[model samples]
Target: MEHIRNFCIIAHIDHGKSTLADRLLDMTNAISEREKMDQVLDNMDLERERGITIKSHAVQMYYKFEGKEYTLNLIDTPGHVDFSYEVSRAIAACEGALLIVDASQGIQAQTISNLYLALEHDLEIIPVLNKIDLPSANPEEVSDQIIDLIGCKREDIIPASGKTGQGVDKILEAIVKRIPAPKGDPNAPLQALIFDSVYNPYRGIEAYFKVVNGTIRKGQRVKFMATDKVYNADEIGILQLKQYPKDEISAGDVGYIVSGIKDAREVKVGDTITSADNPADAPIEGFEEVKPMVFAGVYPVEIDQYEELRSSLEKLRLNDASLTFEPESSAALGFGFRCGFLGMLHMEIVQERLDREFNMDVITTVPNVSYIAYMKKDPTVPVKVNNPADFPDPVKLDRIEEPYIKAQIISKSEYVGSIMKLCIDKRGILKNQVYLTSDRVELTFEMPLAEIVFDFYDRLKSISRGYASFDYYPIGYRESDLVKVDILINGDPVDALSALVHRSNAYDIGRKMCEKLKELIPRQQFVIAIQAAIGSKIIARETISALRKDVTAKCYGGDITRKRKLLEKQKEGKKRMKQIGSVEIPQKAFLAVLKLND
Candidate 1:
């Protein structure tokens, strides 16, 4: 157990976590020269294309230090705030973390947030200054920041460049010397915490876990404590670039168990796996349930694919445990699942995955944060409302409370004015601000979760010229004057497009939604009326003229009365069509509401 060092890499998005991971793998000789690649741990094409890690990946490495063979279990985690749950789980399974900070960008929001997470888990933090090779890199300044943030000594911070492989050997030496090894009793009953899982179509679900106590052997009957379901371990193995089957994996080791469990729902992340015969007294604790901040409806483009969508979501959830969904139906979109996502980026990635991985074309409705609606009759009972369609009648509602978040933004001092303006426009209150350096500032704000769900991040990035890093966490609910805004097409309310928004911005947002929908929705045979309403009051309206076929061209040479008759006939036909014509809202229209500011 002393020879086993389990740790993860934590950082802000694009702070060279994956690049540093590659160098570590190369130095440890975990992967052959032929297998060397950029972001080798990020296997998803979407991840590589976006230049970000979306999922946490784990691999085992063998490093020889001073003639002693040491086993290193390295878990690479995503740096985005939307995938913080991935970082949390990775931290839970390890004893230490490499806090990577970009020397040029210094300490950003996610960098601080992830460090706090690692600290909360009592993991040893190794501050590493990455991207030292950049021309603009300021290692001395960043080192000072790291020292102030984590209270580490100056020499303890390692200045490393993940690109040129500089200081990688020193990093390995630090991992061996600084990070504590896994501690557990091999004689105790089997208690393995499943940190992550993946679905294998040919084999079954492969659960990746860390053995905290006792041994997990091949062919052992294991029971998942959370599900209380037992299954024979078809194969037990260590995770390298590939799975290497082992007869047994003892305590303080990281490995995988393939039990031929075809049902994806049967396996749950953070569940404890124990020996069925001699089970542990209790399951491992400290893994909190993932709380999704953003909620939206994911409906199949084709209604008949509902069951297929459900199965796809089930399988996808095996890979991404943070995603939560339940069956829901909408009058506008038919049957669908209301999915809870960590944020806008997570929601977009899931939508992209469903299309590319499952070949499932899905329509995602407007994303919003969940609200607590109190009824006038039952004031004591708080009704949780995630979907706008589930919102109780305003007449019977006493008040609505919206989720608020403590938003931390680190940016250049030059953009402070613009960033503050953007946040304030979103109904945010400035809670605090501090200057980390003469030119760098950290601003904290209390903002409604729903305000930032749409284009806040995009605008912030633009305003800061990509110099800002933002992170946030829910700060519970606060009473607010919020109203349900409904988008009506031809005077019919579309439940999928309804949203609970603050009353202050309701009229402006409604006007923008109407104007955007007018451009996106195609012209029908009759005039299409798009109205944004709050109950019976129409706050905004836009009209798309009918696609005329030039009916009067055939009678151009006729008398004025004859032309009038032809025009009258056409107008009558349009009126009849408008009465029976149901608007077919394009998918872009539903997504346009999310980009109203754009």
Candidate 2:
């Protein structure tokens, strides 16, 4: 264990984390330069297409220093806010972290957020400034900013270019020097932490674990503490960009365990695995379950594809433990699942995977945050409502509490006023602001997560001219003047069209939603009324005239009486159709209105 070093890389998105991982892999001779692809650590095609890391991957590298051989376990982690849960699990299984910041971008919202997480884990941090080859590189300024932000020494900060592969050897050397060896007893009960898991078509659920103590070998029965299910380790292996089967994995080694368990839910992330017979006294501490922060309804475009969609999502969820879903029915989109995700990006990635991987067309409703409502009759009793369809009558609810988040926006000084206004429009409270440097500023606010989940990021980028970066973490619930605004299409409530809105902004939001819906929904044979309401009161309304068939076209040579009879007959048919006819809401309408992010 003295020669073993386990560490992970953390940074803001698009800040050269993956590139640095590639360079390190090449430098350590773990993967040849010819064998490596761009973003080699990122295995998912969606991740490569989006230029982001959607999952965390671990690999073992062999390095030589001072004529001594050392086993280096490097875990590459995602930097996006949505994958913070992934990052946290990786950090829990590591002894140290590499805090990578862009030379030109300097410190970002997530850069600090991830740094705090590492500090909480008490991991030794190695500050590395990346992308020094850029012409706009400002390494000196960025180094000074890190010193001011995190109190790391000036001389300790290392400068490197991930693209150019400069200073990568120095980084590897620092890991061997600064990061301490794993301390565990090989004679103790076998204990391992499952940081990630993936589903295999034939081998069942393959889990990635960091051996904390003892040793695990093939054919041994292991128990997952969270599930209490014991399964024989069909195989054990190391991931060197690919799986390499092995007979045993000793203490302080990072590798994959294949248990013949087919169910994905059985092998959960953050669960502890130990010898089934010689079990540890307790599971590892400091690990918690990942809860989804955003929720949306996912319905198949073709209702008959519901079962296929369900199976596809289940398969996808096997790899993504952060994803959650349950069967849900919508008046507009038919049967589907109410899926929960960590953030908007997570939701998008899952949807894209379903489409690209499964070839299933789906319709997703607008995303929402969970709300807690107090009963009017019993003020002390609180109810957790995950769906708008579950919302009780406004009269029965005494007060509503929506999820709030502590949001941080790092941008230039000139855009501070605009960002403040944008947050205020979303009902954000100004908490504090700090000038990170003369050119850059950090603004902190207590904002409603629901408000910014969709348009906030896009709007922030627009106002800041794409110079600003944003990050947020949930900050519990707060009481608000909230109401569930329901959309009525021709006097019929559409559950999928309902949204939770603040009372003050209800009128404006309701009106805009109605108008957008009016434009999206196609005209029917009979006139359709689009109305948005708060409880029994309709706050906004729009009308779409019926598509005329022009019954008078064929009556040019007919008598006036004949034309009158034709009109009366057509009108009578229209009345009956209005009562019996249901609106056919096009698939595009839901796709266009619900998904404002493009």
Candidate 3:
């Protein structure tokens, strides 16, 4: 149909993409006035709690204007830099993109980055200025910035506040006039691009895709181009901000198809679904596997909860394809999972969900960057090391390459000197700087990805008094003199507490780690010494303060049971610590020391 349009909403984090999607649905009467919902497309609890979309969601709506009916397929995309690859895949599945910019914040670094991605995909860009109802709204300046940055015409900018549903009609009209309708043959072999998928216990695997050619029906058999798996489409439906059963879906329509797929590994996010009998010749291009940048181990607070933790991870991964985990064993923790994530935000979201949603208490190790280990004698046998304890000796390392990023920061000019100092301290190289406004300036730098993976953003915010916004993208790998620092409790090396540090930062990292360990380790019955050493030389050392006295005053004839229980508990806690030979260490102490805030 000529009136059908497929598009997606793109914006920076907190720029109101989901809210705008909700308003558009309401304007089209897709949901009744009495059934109005907040962020209807953000179906996951973690997404709602974080106020950010982790996965791209799809919905269909019907709108009539000037006696013409239009079938609109609206896709909501994640705006955080951690999911940039997913955002790119979503843009590829659409014919047009609505760029939502915050009216008060002007053009942010992520806004420019996402806009560039949309432009690269050659999607028809319809710039919409959102949050115009805010007290500090500046639509005129934002419109000018959009024109200058994206080279869009001045009249192309549509100002609206998704909160109040203002100027939203203009956005719908622009979609019809500026964005071209889907061009495909409804009679040809079926070809659908699966942009997202989820797993449900009752219904199995549900995949959401957009039909580019032909038609898909409930009883039809389909095959995935990427995995070559075949299945009979048990059900077909359209998303009206909620699942609505449909007999069939034609070209340019976005909907979901459910089958008996129980394993999530079979249904990938970017896989293509086509007719089994008359499949398309080739799969849709531009889908790449997402690679996680940060790796950490998640251990349960209680040893008996191992199975529960594993089950929780499985269920969480079923809904989120980006989160990854593998079974890991530790001498101290016994059984745990080594989890991988796209970035720091992704790791935090997963951890928070495990605690709040699943009701599981977990202790996580420090996050680490992946490394490639090269041996002198066996140069061809390169080992991929995710944990610092796995790194080979210094003599075996020929060269080390670490991931780098192109970082950008927007802040007031008054804090320029402090920002510069912080960047230099992190071994960052200044790339460029520009004044966005009279008081606002943007600084670009090339820095090690590992440096900012922890709390660099938080530190920057504190120094700037919450006046700065930061964003970064992976550039490539660069050669650096990096070594693995192993921490020892008494005599035995604690693998979970080890870290990879540049040669220049070894001393500072060691000192910071010792201080954190002092605070994390409680006063012991006997004095315990913590030391960070390289080779046979000690770089940093600290002693935990000894306990003043034992609780002997509460002991009595009947209280003997309670005293014995307390002493047993204390001994049990000591046994969990890795025994180097004579020194007693606590497992919690190692975990706490690994997290160096400074």
TM-score of each model, paired residue for residue: 0.99, 0.97, 0.90
- Give lDDT tens digits, candidate 1, residues 92-209: 9999999999999899999999999999999999999999999999999999999999998999999899999999999999999999989899999999999999999999899999
The TM-score obtained by model 2 is 0.97
Model 2 per-residue lDDT tens digits across residues 1-598? 8999999999999999999998998888888767878889888899888899988889899999999999999999998888898888889999999999999999999999989999998899999999999999999999999998779799889899999999998898899999989889888999998888887888887889999999999999889998889889989999887899999988998999887888767877778899999999998884567888889999988889999998888878777878999998986778999999999889889989888888988888878888999997898988998888989888778998999999999999999999999999889999999998898999999989889877788789899998898899888999998888988999999888788888887898788878887888888899999998998899999999998788888877857998889889999999999999999876566555444334
lDDT of 3: 0.83
Check candidate 1 and list the clashing pairs.
none
Candidate 1, superposed: residue stretches over 4 Å from native: 556-558
TM-score of 1: 0.99
Ranking by TM-score: 1, 2, 3
Q: What pairs collide in candidate 2? A: none
The candidate with the higher lDDT, 1 or 2, is: 1
Estimate, for each residue in 210-237, the C-alpha lDDT of model 3 and write its tens digit: 8888899998999998889999999999
Winning candidate number (lDDT): 1
Higher-scoring candidate on TM-score, 1 or 3: 1
Please estimate how well model 2 matches the true structure, expressed as its whole-model Cα lDDT.
0.88
RMSD of 2: 1.7
lDDT of each: 0.93, 0.88, 0.83
